[model samples]
Target: MRVAVLGGGLQGCCVALALAERGIDAAIFDRNDQLLSRAAVANEGKIHLGYMYANDVSYSTARMMMQGALAFAPFFARHLGSSQDSLSISRPAAYVVHRDSQRSPGQVSQYLKTVHGLIREASGRRGDAYFGRDLTTAPRMWSEAEREAEFDPQIALAAFDTAEVAIDPAALAGAVRSRIEADPRIDVRLQHQVTSVDDADGFDVVLQARCGILRERFDHVVNALWDGRFAINETRGLRPDRPWLHRLKYGVSFRLPRGTSLPPSATFVSGPFGEVVSYADGLTYLTWYPVCLQGISTDVTPPEWPTYPAEPLRSDLLQGTLKAMAQFVPCLRGLDPGGLEEVTVKGGVIVAWGETDIYDPRSELHRRFEIGVTSRGRFHSVDPGKLTMAPYFAEVCAGRILQDIVR
Candidate 1:
């Protein structure tokens, strides 16, 4: 049977690859020439050691992430045609550093213990099939002076040795795409814009572009639009309740000098404006810059507030970040400003379900099934973390599609 996957983003490509692996013919379609390109470009290339959301209680998200990480391993290895050593799957010892006065060391310890226990429990239930073994242990506290000596001079107390992995997000996605395209069963059409979908005599998917209207028929179709839910609503003429549309804030990456000594591991620093900062490929990246003012999403992105752009690099945000960095590692202060090369500002409404849910599981499932049901289809969506999760998503979607068709 022929299947049409909508969107050439990671999700769509993954779903298509899975379908192809099952000996099913699938066609991937996208309206954007730069599918997954935007999200891919903004990536810091971290494989994520599963600690980013250690505090999250969402069992489903946690479970998916764990399973997804493992699934990604083989998929990436095969797709990239590279050994584990070449992939930069750096299993670094992660840390969460906070000021001693801001939060008690005991509270921080408790938090780590709770998260570690949860990870262990979750891994145990999943057996060796998931990331149970790969999960990192909770961090241990370091004295203020010791942290200063080891890191930089500004560090107070350091919680070191948590599990985390890092990678080049763009390279990873490109590798996956390259591998999938090698298979003749899959056809990736670039510069094709899918404007609408209709169930006429058969499933008709329409494409509108500068060229003209192109049409294709498919037995199944999937919709995976990153932040572009409006396209789906316009195409299907259906308005599904999406509470978590744009509630997330992100940061841009600034390329540091060619020869800057970065920390060996990724660090999560909490201060007046907590941020996730990491240095890779001579670029120091900072994200989660708050745009909220007075506890509300304000016009001004905060912690650094008004001083941004005018002084960009010297802005309050970067200064606070630098201060936090110094607290964790004193050497950061001495790092030459000449080493700072370029800065890219990236802030967007992170998709979420109200303030509580970050992802819509139900909508995701529906979109997957829609693609599976379509013949000769493709789908796309922007996900900086797409490389780590798309493989499993593809496998699951393919299995579901086959099941639906056979039954």
Candidate 2:
């Protein structure tokens, strides 16, 4: 049987690959000219272990993230046909708690310890390694002297070094694309925007392309579009039942000059601060929430925004991101922006279940346990909330769809 995987981002590609492996012919539809060119390639690829969601006191978000993080290495290694060590893994992150963060240092520290304990237990039980690293030890908090030396004391209240690391999504996307191209059962349909889906024994997927509208029938359909997922789901009478937000967040990527030194890739915690990641491959990524965040929409479909900012606006974002990041990573304070090589600014739409932003201590953004595969008979809608959840949730979506066929 043939399957239709809507949207060729990471989630769609993963689902397509999984189905192809099962001897099912699958077609992937995307608006971009190429696969994995949108949100899948943009943004910092943080394989979160739930340390950032300190405000979610229930620990559910952290637990869900840990499960996905554990499965990330093996899942991609199997699909990409490469060893986990070959992936571009960033340096372990030092989570710094800001002086005015929504959660206190003590509260954040307690939450991290609890999450780490769960991670260790789950890893041991399944014998699943996180990026091939040994996570037997707990995260270590920095001393006052160490914290002062690594970060500006005025902004940073405390720091902890965890085994959490980020994979370069750009590199990972290339590997995934190669695998998809080599697979015979998976078809890649570029520049095809899925306008809607209708029930017709199976499903009829309507598409909008330059040539005009087109339609195709499939035994099953998966709604995996991040940009217009809600709109397509609504066409199938599956409107959202809860409050949500589609936030457009930006990230800056630049290459550092030779022999440039930087602190460990760090993330400021429990609020709308920012993060600075210096990858081993000489590429540095910076994102300051207050400046890089562009727009937010509560509608089923978010308003269109340029993925790449032009002119002085782009320069403003780069300068502002670095300046804001330096508030915590003191080493970047006086670095000349001109010295940075190949600087580029790009962002993607982030769909989450929240009415407010992360600034609020009580915002639903603090937790992300509400996402995954949701199905209504033969049609499925997936919301892989973060990049970390894409592979794991894709497996779930594929398995559930296969089970439906058996019955």
Candidate 3:
């Protein structure tokens, strides 16, 4: 069957690749010239272990993520020329220390036990075995001596050793794209923006180009726009009735001085401002990636977000991030404050709802409805783990499409 997958971003690439693997002819389209550019330039590129979600997770989103992590490993090894050695699995403990009160030792143990149980069950293991034996935890109010002991003075009740895997998102996307392009059945059209999709005996995919409007007929179409669902629908006059579209926000990342290290590997530091911080690459790079609050909306592009200098310097947001870093890493206060060099920010719309959004099948409402009925079926709305979970999603979507065709 001929298929058209819109958006050359990570999701679209994966979907196209998966279809090609099934011996189905497929093509990919994207409007962005720099589809994987931002992720390639910035991000420490950590491949996440599926343990982030709880054991009782029943949502399609969660299943896709879990299955994707497992699927991506072999796909990367076989197609992308990635080796198992390139991957580093670490159990970095995460902690949530209260400001005023102390959690009892029993409470800490119980918490860890619950977490361990969840991880074990999710990983399909029996008994009380912890998923990451190296993972451990400790809780204590920081003494002044303790404050001076580590790089981050504010750390309390260190939650140590949670399952985390880091990989380059850009490299992963490029690898998948390369593999798909190698297949004779797959045709990748870069810089081609699909404008509409119509089902007339079959599916008619329309594209808007500088010269004129272009159209291609396919047996099926899949929309894989990462956070661009609303924009695409509006463009096609097929906006969903429900308020499913999420607000757009920016993720700001800055390159720290070449050699800084945080003790106990990478940790997510919770700040007073309700922001999360993580250290990577010998602590030389710190990201103040903002988790956009739910229900907030923005039309601002990444390059237009508030910046530091008139020209290419550092972003103002990055400066604010450094200030926050100083609260925990006091040594930062003594370092020579240099101008922000090469600050790359990725601005896109994201679903900012609570944890429930990640695993809900209803969240796929727009995608499912758009595919079969509307000519606007060429886009996909996905959650945060789109890159990590693309393979599973592709399989599921392909299965659904096949079922529909058969029926």
- Tens digits of lDDT, candidate 3, 150-268: 44534444433444455544345555555666779778776676666665666677788666788788777777765554455555465555444343334344445565444332334
* Highest lDDT against the true fold, candidate: 2
TM-score of each: 0.71, 0.97, 0.69
Q: How does each model score on lDDT?
A: 0.52, 0.87, 0.47
What root-mean-square deviation over C-alphas does model 1 reach?
A: 7.0
The superposed Cα distance between candidate 1 and the true structure at residue 316, in angstroms, equals: 10
What is the overall TM-score of model 1 with all chains considered together?
Answer: 0.71
Compose the digit string of candidate 2's lDDT tens values, residues 314-367. 889999888877766877776788778988798889999988999888999988
- Ranked by lDDT from best down, the candidates are 2, 1, 3
lDDT of 3: 0.47
User: Model 1, residue 97: what's the lDDT?
Assistant: 54
User: Which run of 10 residues does model 3 get worst, by summed lDDT?
Assistant: 365-374
Predictions ranked by TM-score, top down?
Answer: 2, 1, 3
Candidate 1 structure quality by residue, lDDT tens digits, 21-60: 7888888776556545544434444544344443333434
Candidate with best TM-score: 2
